[model samples]
Target: MKRFLGFIEKEFYHIFRDKRSLFILFGMPIAQILLFGFAITNEINNVEIAILDHSKDATTGEIINKISASKYFSINQFIEQEADIEAAFKKGKIKAVLNFENDFSKNLVKEKQATIQVITDATDPNTANTISNYINSILQNYQLDQNKDIKIVYQIVPQTRMIYNPELKSVFMFVPGVMTIILMLVSAMMTSISITREKELGTMEILLVSPLKPFQVIIGKVVPYIFLSMINAVVIILLSIFIFKMPVQGSLFLLGLESVLFIITSLTLGILISTISATQQTAMMISLMGLMLPVILLSGFIFPISSMPAPLQIISHFIPAKWFIIILKGIMLKGVGISLLWKETLILLAMTLFFIGLSIKKYKIRLE
Candidate 1:
């Protein structure tokens, strides 16, 4: 027991001794959490837009006032001619241009509807779509206000609602995926690199020849990473809760347990990778190319897996992060219990077992 504890201490020393590794382990999680939480978000804010009001009427002025007053947009400039619209967009600061048709108030009084041309820069499709939606919403609100004093013959009001994320904050969508990625980076990438570094430094053979068994050696190497990764997990959760005001509606205990399961799964994957790779560079490449890409692209982190092509959807099932992401969003967003997440939990467990078995088999063969 003393010897095993000493080996664990030695591994800790190896980790803390390397400045680059320390930074990657600690600094990356904070930087990534801050970046994803604060900077990378889908919510639009104070978009600069140019307006062209051909009518120059009271109603058009009111609509413009409402639009400019709303937090979503700031009127950059009101242009005189239509030709200037293209130049404004070409300059690249403005996201949208709102053009009211001539005699907008007269048309509304005569036909009960007025035309408004919303020209948006399609450079960023999402941003453009959001800008258009905001404009439409503001117009709809103004129209409702106009009709509030008058009686309507037949009104069919469609009440659209959003559950879970009512405000649709992108942070809610990204937190789970970011947590998964951080765990993957620490568990799989770090462990694989640590093990490979040992082999490269000629220290792994010394341990292999020591009184300690191979299983003990592997466990010793991975245990420190598991603790460090969990610390990272805690930090991420705390940041989401306090800074972002993100609620963990489900069982915090379940979240932690599932996190541990994923951590173990990631650690086993690193072990499997290390067994196959003889050099640190090879392990790092495999972790980034093979693991990172699949986790980021295929895991339904940024893109919905269901929306993917049939072939890619089929391939995504093999990616562990997909299941983990579902588990995360379920627990964090929906507040779901284990009863709801049994399948994903079981899948992660099975993957963990498979990787551990394969790694052990390969390591034994290498020993022979």
Candidate 2:
């Protein structure tokens, strides 16, 4: 019993001494729980929406005020005309637009009913559905409030139109998200171990003594994975198109170019991970734990980013997957060209350069 107790104490000491173990045991759980608790939510708050008041009457004004008063949505803009709605959605700021039919108050008084068209950008179908429902609920409550003392009960009918994805196909949303995850993880996981494996197997010294330069070594390590990841991306895109009947409304050439850029970004990030890590296991852990959760949760793939707390929303901007997902959705669903997508494209390019530069610096440090 004394010997067993001594062994147990030794194990505890070992665990406490290793920072990685301590982090895994205590830090990771706390972080994961906090992230999950905050990130994984269905309810949206401060979702940006637009209003196109055709009637511009007291009734429309009251309804708009009620929607704006709710905690669920914020009125981002008041659109001028019907033609601008498509342009607004393509800009990717507004999620839903409330279009009050002409003569709304007069119709409510004379015909005892009025129609408000709820047009939503359904690239993310779940969010679009939720927005439509919330607006409908607000209209219903307003109707009830106005009908309290009247013999003729007034009705406000909400007609919801889901653009881009009229059927609200969940797959339309998931394909882009899954594709982003696959490209991010596979590319990162593959090259993350490249340098660590060399270090572990005593081959790093051989490379160190070779005629090849540091950049040459780094490029050599990453170039193969670039081709492999590209193939993986092509396969995923083809499968999505043929099997799922997913449409690529934008230019295929542009899509290919963007995919290549993201793949390079992910691969360079993997190289950076490889340079910093001491062991293959460590590299793998960092790549999986550090990359996967953020990609899934904060990328606005599963949940709306605008719905999250202000801090998480700010942190999400740092997530490359979030930008890549935006690019994919823009190209696939909205069919917007590079003119509209230039900002996101530039952000990915900048990230790629940043990762490459950092990897080179880290590699030089290892050489010294």
Write one digit per residue (lDDT tens) for candidate 1, span 1-368: 99999999999998898765665578656644643444334556678888888999998888889988987788999999999876676444576788787888887777666788887754334455566777778877877788888874222121222335556577887888899999998899999999999988989989988999877998899999999999999999999999998889889999999999999999999999898877797789778766886787678677544334456667788888988988887777667788778999999999999999999899889878
Best candidate (score: TM-score): 2
lDDT of each: 0.79, 0.91
Instruction: Give the per-residue Cα lDDT of candidate 1 at 161.
Output: 27
Model 2 lDDT, residue 20, Cα: 69
Worst 10 residues of 1 by lDDT: 153-162
Best by lDDT: 2
Worst 10 residues of 2 by lDDT: 20-29
TM-scores for every predicted model = 0.60, 0.95
Model 2's alpha-carbon lDDT is 0.91
Question: Which residue runs of candidate 2 sit more than 4 Å off their true CA positions?
Answer: 1-21
